[model samples]
Every structure is written in C-alpha cells, then in structure tokens.
Target: MEIPENYPKKYWHCHIEVDTGGKKNTSAIFNDLTIKELWQQVVSPWHTHRPFTVDGTIVRDYDKVQKIKITQTEHPQSYYAEQHNASMQRKGIADMATNRRLLPLSKGKDYTHEFLFADLTMNDNEQEKVVSNNKIFIVHGHDEQVKETTARFVEKLGLEAVILHEQANEGKTIIEKLEKHTDVGFSLVLLTPDDVGATVTDKENLKPRARQNVLLELGYMAGKLGRGKVCALKKGDVEIPSDLIGVLYVEIDAAGAWRLQVAKELKVAGLGVDLNNAI
Candidate 1:
C-alpha cells in the first residue's frame, strides 16, 4: 500500500478483528501501516460492514473497533528507511537518536483483554547501571589547584573523577578520547583563567578566559550529559561563555562553600553524595 505523504513512516504490527455472527470472526494482522493512517485508510473503510452482531446479541460498527493491538517496529519501510538513513548519516552519530533494540512481542498481563507491548529497549538493570554511575568527568584548564581540589572533593563523596589527560590515549584523537570516557553520569567543568582574549576591534583590552580546549570540553560534556548533569566551578575572574548562561556554576571561594553547592548538585543529579562529606 502507498502510504500518505503526510503520515509518519513508522511500521506498526496491528492485530485487528471484525465482528461476525456466531461464526468465526475475521481476524488479520496489518504490518506495513502507521496506526493513524491504518485507521483512516483501511479500518475506516470497513465501516460499510456496519450493524454487525457478535455472540448473537451485542451490536457493533466496523468503525467502532473492538480491539486494536499496535506495536511499532524498529525500522520503517525501505523507501522511508532510506530517506531517514540518509538524513541521519548527514547529521552524524553525535546528533543521532539514542540507540534502541526491539524485543520479541509477548502476551500481555491480562491475556484476555490486551497484548503486552514490546519490552522497552533499556531494561531496569541497564537503567540502574546508568543511574548508579559513580564516575564524574572533570573538564579542567591550567589551574592545577582548582582541578586537584575538585577531584579530591569528588573522591571524598566516594565518586571517581575522570580526568581526560590521566586516561590512556590508545592512539585516539582528543575528541575520540573524550567520547570514550564520557560514560560517566555527571561532569564537573573547572572554568579557570588560563588565557586572555578580546574582540577583534579591541586587542589591548583582553580579558581572562578559560583555555579553549577547556571550553570545548565543557560544551561537549554538557551536550553528552545533560546540563543538569554537568556543573561548572568558576575560579577567580574568568569570562563566562554567553551561550552557557543557564548552566549552574558554583564559585570557588576561600571559605570552601563551593563544595557544599557542588555536592548538592551531584545529589540532585541522582548521584550518591553525603552532604557531610563536603564538610
């Protein structure tokens, strides 16, 4: 069947049944149509078989579907799949959707009433592993004091601090290395003044800024792990990126108040943090 141009290209496995008096009901599976388009172009047309009786007493209309079981599959039809694949390839894997695996369909809990949908791609065990991640990526600049302090703080909370340079290169590029180590549940960005920069028209009026690589990794971490999972520790006076306005940044003060703030953020991000550890 030629799908409508406007309809979504998802493939659905639908189990439908048409009412027929005492005799056997007409049951069929339509595998190539989206639920919306299937209802409109196919099921709706069956309305002409109206006023049909089931079990010799109950009356029903074909349009008034008695039961609909729909399970969306992994890929669309070839034509739609090709189009989607081309678009995704152009955007690259970094921009691609999360990876998912389809599971075999199983019977629903109440076998008589409904069919159990496919199991979610990520099971409870996988989700628990992600949520229970104990490592925190540390995106730092040239400020050794700030970096060490932050790493120590994370360790105090019983969490591992993933410093990029400390990890094995294994012949991987910088970005590739970063990607490999981004399996952590949270990221701590150290924004320290390691460089000076100003607009093209104002060369002499340069201001303090974090290292270019530090800023790049900060953005990368923020994107990989959501903003809530990434926290920035601003040390001294550094030029903050305008694009990262909404990100949380705790100031590195002499009184060590930043530790408590960071610990709280970590707790909010679902990490196991003891606030007393910060003390």
Candidate 2:
C-alpha cells in the first residue's frame, strides 16, 4: 500500500480516553496524525494485551484501538459518526464480549461493557460493509448531536448503521464510495442550517440551507433508492429543492423523537422492524 503524504495542512486533533476501572481514565491525545495511523501507532500498542481479563471485563481495551471514530470536529455527532459502537465485524466469542455471560455477575443490576473508542481520526471513506446487515445510511451536515443520537438509535433497533466519515476510503472520493456501497436499503437525511444559497439571478436573497455536500448526497439518495426509501429529518431553518416536494421532510426541533416514524418507514421498506415495542 502506498503511504499517504502527511499533509502540512491536515493536522488531526485527537483525544484518547483509556479506562482501567476504579473510576480512573486518561485523556485523549491530539496530534498531527490521521485516525488510521493513530490506531497503528498509539492505540494498538496498549489497547489489548495478555491475560484476557480485567475487572470482570474480557479484553483489555478490545476494539478501543481497532475501530476509531472519525469526525470533522471533536463532537460526537458531526456527519458520519461511529453509529454502532459494537462493531459487527468481529467474528468469534473471543472478541465479542456481549455474547458471553454478564460480568460482575449482578442478578438485577445488568452491568455490561464494551470498548467505546471515541477519539481523533478520519477514515478517508467508510460505511457499514455488511451486505446482509440492516444498513441504515445516515446523511447529515454539521450537526453532531443528531448524528450521534441517530447512530445509537439505529443500533438500538438491532440494525447496522452505515456512517461515511468513519471509514477509510484511501484513494476514492465520497461520491465514488456512495456508488460502490449501493447495498443500502434505507436512508435518513439530517437537514440543518449550515449554508446560505441564492440563485444566480437573485444574488441579494439568501436563505438557510444545508451544505452543498449534503444536498448532493440527498439528490444521490433520491436517484439511487427512490424517495420512498429516504426520509429527511430537518431540525432547523432550512430550504430544500422544489423538485423534492413529493419527498417526506419531517420537521422537528430535536433528534431522537423521529425514531418511531423512521422505524415505521424502514419497516414498510421491508427491514423487518417492530415499531410497536420500540420507544
């Protein structure tokens, strides 16, 4: 593999949190390195080690090193956050901690733990790679809370949430990756005011709108999966295209409230979701 030139302009700000129980944890590191390189350098070394047991939990740090969370900012949501904290990639029971019996062995307490590696890094390109998984493609602008909440909600429903910003696409562009990952069945677009657009003839009039990239993704989704398979959850003041009049853009002040409607739509699209029990 060709090594990426460490661009002087692109310095990654990272924050690592290492917890070994007893309420002790270390802060993340912010430096001039990509998420992939950090995994190979810092995380991999101390993430998991021998003995295979610590304070009732299985692996030391587990995937805390392997699966790095990518974002434009330090916040949790911004764009394609690591939705599924527990990666479906791990194969056997050795790596999968939740598969075995509960640790600490509390009858009524139900204490469970997994490596949540939320830190600095950028995957040039990423989405859920599982072809058989219930993949929900979440598209958004700069909102972090909505994206993070959406990812958690999707995982709560036992479905795979495919996030773009967390994957390493090495040499390809975002548009290229979208064309490649066509196995996705459903899409949730988050529209927030991040940009202002005015027509060429009417330069004086400016209105709240999503970023150009978000618009491009939305248009791509409409063409690739049809309007029925996509839902736009607009949070703030934003204007959309007139052609998308038939598309459903639900207005909401918050994020998690739209799960029921989104789940219902996913069910109709043949995802086998039970919205009745979901809250």
Candidate 3:
C-alpha cells in the first residue's frame, strides 16, 4: 500500500556498511513506509503479529516521492551503527515536522521524541575560544590497586578519566558495555593476567581468550579513527597479542614511569594533556 503524503512520510534511502576487514556486514534503509512494508512481509509468512525492530529505532514516517542522499558506511562498530540509524530516523521525522527546515519535531501524536539536526556545514557567526579537552576511559581488571593507580595517573595529567568496573549483567552484557564506551577521545586498557584468560564462547563451543574483547574494541575503533586512537597499557609484562603487533603501547614500570610515558605520547599525538595534573 502507498503511504499517504500528508501523514508524515519522508524520503527513502539505503546503504551498506563495510568493516576494516573489508566485509560488507549489514545494509539498511531510511524510509518509514518501506520499513513497515518489509516488517509486514516478514511476519505475514509466520502469521505472528507484533512490531519488528531492526534495532531500537523504529520507522514511523513513509514517503515515496522524495529522495534522500544515501551514504554507505563500511565496518562500523555497534556503537556507530546504532547512532547512524537513529540519526536517519530523526532526520526523516524532522523534515515532516518543520516543513523542510532542520528543526526538532513538535511533540504530538505522530512523533515521540523531538529531533534537532544542526547544520554542520553552516558556519556560525559567533565562535567561542576552544579549550583542548581529552577524556580517557579506563577499562580496569579485578585488581583494585591497579585501577586506583591508573586513575591517579590520569588525575595527575589533568585529563578527565573514569575507571569502568564492568561486572557481567543480564541487561547490559560485558561486550555491549565495552562497545558502548570504547569510542571516547582515548581508551586505556589495563591488561591483567586474569583479563588475558577471560573468554566468551560461541554456540560452537569454541572459546577465545578474554583479551580478545579488548582487541576487538580496539580493532573496531581503529577501523574508524585509525591506529593511534587506541593504546594498550601493560600492567605487569604480559605478552602482546599477535593482532596488536601494529598497535603502539607503553609498558608499566616501577614508580609509574609508564603513566608519564603515556602522557607524553598523548601530547605528541595532539591530545592535550595537563602536565600539572599529572602530579
């Protein structure tokens, strides 16, 4: 069935995402009508009735005449994939809400959340002085002292740092948490002996080491921002993984020399570091 024009339908578009491994993993579209039709087609065979989720973001608007710019992104991590889909749905609804002006949708029956699309290309007349800021996410192991020392080191450097102690939960899986938070300005992975042995097995019962998760997180980010964005910090002389041979890292030593070394390296890489805070 053709979607009604006045009933809040938007332009349609599709794209494919590729990973650093050059694999085309997933494809998606940005039309409200097409998505609903597809959902019907999937359920019509089974005769079970329920709304479908490609992810959490749902397609509500469906327009056929309008054309949207389609950009294909390859090899995006889970974090990026969710963001990209949400952005498209928001944009589609925003067009209907504001007569083509890039504005938040009005709160009403047709739309749920208001979406604000800032024109990134349009330069603002007023610009504020930029302060160089860096946020480092610390993925810690079971070692409390190591976590605290790392936090203290980050505190010394004047950079905003938060040590994430991830415990397995039924709601938010460890993998999801890592993927969700790994895309910060920088990530500090404290690799412990226990962490190296940690592994999540698949249906086939094949188990990989736990350190593999950290590598996957780094691999996902490196695919987007390149190699320098991620760093592996050695807690106590753990052997580097074969996959991480190309990644640059610092070794932790007595008196916390590794912290100082990392701070220096970050600054050299154009990441602003507060030397006074590094005390």
Candidate 4:
C-alpha cells in the first residue's frame, strides 16, 4: 500500500500547547467517531464534539485562540506504552481535553485555538500579526518628559501607546497593573539614570541606573512579548543586565536621533510604518 504525502495517516496524537505563561498542556484530536465514543465509555466525564463555526477569528467559547505549532516532537514513554497503562493515559488525556472552563493564568482564555487536523483558516504567523497589530506598552520610572516624548512619536505614527502609569493603581501591585496590558504587540523600556544604588559591601561608589520598577518591567516584557519586540532606550549610562546583553537598545543622545531606531521596531511589531516618514 502506497501512502501518499497528502494522505490522512491516522494516529492518536495530542496537540500540546506551549503557552507564554510557561505552561504546557494538551488539547487532543480524535480522528473518527468510534475512537471518540470509545473514550466516552471509559473516561468518567466524557465530552462529545460541539458545533464549531469557522470565522476570521476562531470563536471558541467566546474567546480567540492564538495558534502555535507543536515545538516538541518526542512524547513521554507513558503516552506510547499501551494495554493496561494506556487506559490511564487515555483518561488523563480526556481529563485535560474536557477540563476547560477558562485558562485565566495566561491572560485568561485566548480562544485563539489550533490543533493537528483542526479546521482553521489562518496559520501561526498570520495570527501573530493580527493579534500584535494593536498597541505598544511603554515601561518607565520617573521620566515623565521622556515618556511624553516617546508617546507623542508613537501617536503621530498612528498607533495606540500604553503606559503603566496611566493604569488605575487601586492599590494593585506594580506587576498586576503592568500585566493588564500584556496583549500589546510590543514594549518600550526607558533606561534613564533616575535612581542611584550602591553595592552592599561598598556604600561609597554610586551607580546610575533606571528604577527597580523599570528593570523588573523590562525583564517581564522580554519574557512575555519576547526580546525581539522589547526595546531598551538608554538616556544615560544605565547598567545593562547580563541576561539582556544582546537585546536591542537605542541610545538617546542630545541629538535626539532615537526616533528612527524606535520607529523601525514599531514597523516590525505590525505598524504600517514608513521609515522615510520623518518622526
């Protein structure tokens, strides 16, 4: 028997997701009804397929699922070993498949769904573009002038600019306030030497760096939106953490030429930017 490249070679495989919040969970795919019905018989709380409508944005439980590829190829030996052990594995898979009310941890239920052989129009890259085309977050500490300068540029370019400062504090921790805007396509971290710190052992020498909030926000933005979408603008000789040694940065000198550099990053982050357009 010849297996054509386009042939639907069926096997029980799970589409495990690698989420931005550092969680790995599975969403299964059952090829035929017999398998789905068989699992229903064994699993305590069984799930029958629901009517799914395919629109431009996948509507799963009233949320949009952001599609991502299965980055891992190898599965645990338990998922492969069959017979007695297979029963537990199947049950575990079933539980994961149905235990879905909301995934609030990673920004709460991004119905941006995808799985192997699942019917959907767009791919992962297209989803990224569509989702990231909205806003850009600017993280700063005690540099209102700099923030105002940057915000003006972002607005003139025709995109929404977000600042952690504008968010309602309401006694919320700094992190909680910042993460509320995690859906932004990109982040700008202003590294102005606003705060000075001394080493524990030597209190004599002072170091110039951004505030602790700025540093923490930069690291968080790098992890969530990814390093490529996060930019560090240096207005002074701020200490660059070793982990962010290779991240992109634009030095702001008196010449004020950082505009073009920042614009380039915005263009990639989904803004329809014209580099020639003077900022």
Winner by lDDT: 1
Error of 2 at 221 (Å): 1.3
Model 1 residue 236 lDDT? 87
How does residue 147 of candidate 2 score in lDDT? 83
Tell me each candidate's TM-score.
0.59, 0.50, 0.45, 0.57
Model 4 earns a TM-score of 0.57
Instruction: Pick out the ten consecutive residues of candidate 4 with the lowest summed lDDT.
Output: 42-51
* Total clashes for model 3: 12
Winner by TM-score between candidate 3 and candidate 2: 2
1-279: candidate 1 lDDT, tens digit per residue: 122355345565455566555476565444555656654444332222212222222223434345545555555444444555677788774434522211111221121122223332444543544544688999999889888988998999999998989999999998889877876768999999999999999989999999999888888877666677789999888999999888899899999999999999999776789999999
Query: What is the model-wide C-alpha lDDT for candidate 2?
Result: 0.57
Top model number, TM-score: 1
Against the correct fold, how does model 3 do in TM-score?
0.45
Report the C-alpha displacement of residue 279, candidate 2, in angstroms: 1.3
Q: In candidate 2, residue 226 scores what lDDT?
A: 63
* Candidate 4 lDDT, 178-226, residue by residue in tens: 7666657678889988988888998988888789878888898887666
For model 4, the superposed segments whose C-alpha errors exceed 4 Å read 1-132, 169-172
